[model samples]
Target: MFPNEWLWRNKLIALLVLVIVIELVLFLVPWERF
Candidate 1:
């Protein structure tokens, strides 16, 4: 049970980081063509 909880937390953190990186990329790059 402890291992499962730890994995879940890691997954959540990874997802959050991925979202932040995506947001940063969008902010830095111009999307006028899209």
Candidate 2:
């Protein structure tokens, strides 16, 4: 099979971005104010 460098790079970048977004929303976002 031929190597696909562009596709691999895009997939990895997408995954990294997804993880960063999830972490920010779950750990950094404040919903309750007292």
Candidate 3:
């Protein structure tokens, strides 16, 4: 595969992981303390 395509795919995966992490943190943490 081309380097550009690989880079794009890596970026997308990284973004998805980041979003999942944020969602998990929000879901696990208590909201009433804020």
lDDT winner: 3
Please report how far candidate 1 places residue 1 from its true position, in Å: 9.7
Model 3: per-residue lDDT, tens digit, 1-34? 5799899999999999999999999999999989
TM-score of each: 0.81, 0.69, 0.88
Question: Model 3, stretches more than 4 Å misplaced?
Answer: none
Model 2 scores a TM of 0.69
Compose the digit string of candidate 1's lDDT tens values, residues 1-34.
5788899999999999999999999998888968
What TM-score would candidate 1 get against the native? 0.81
Decide which is better by lDDT, 2 or 3: 3
lDDT per residue, candidate 2, 1-34, as tens digits? 6469988998999999999999998887776752
Candidate 3 residue 1 C-alpha distance from true site, Å = 10
lDDT of 1 at 32: 92
Number of clashes recorded per candidate: 0, 0, 0
Q: Give RMSD (Å) of candidate 1 vs. truth.
A: 2.0
Q: Could you give the candidate ranking by lDDT, starting with the highest? A: 3, 1, 2
Instruction: Kindly report which residue pairs in candidate 1 clash with one another.
Output: none
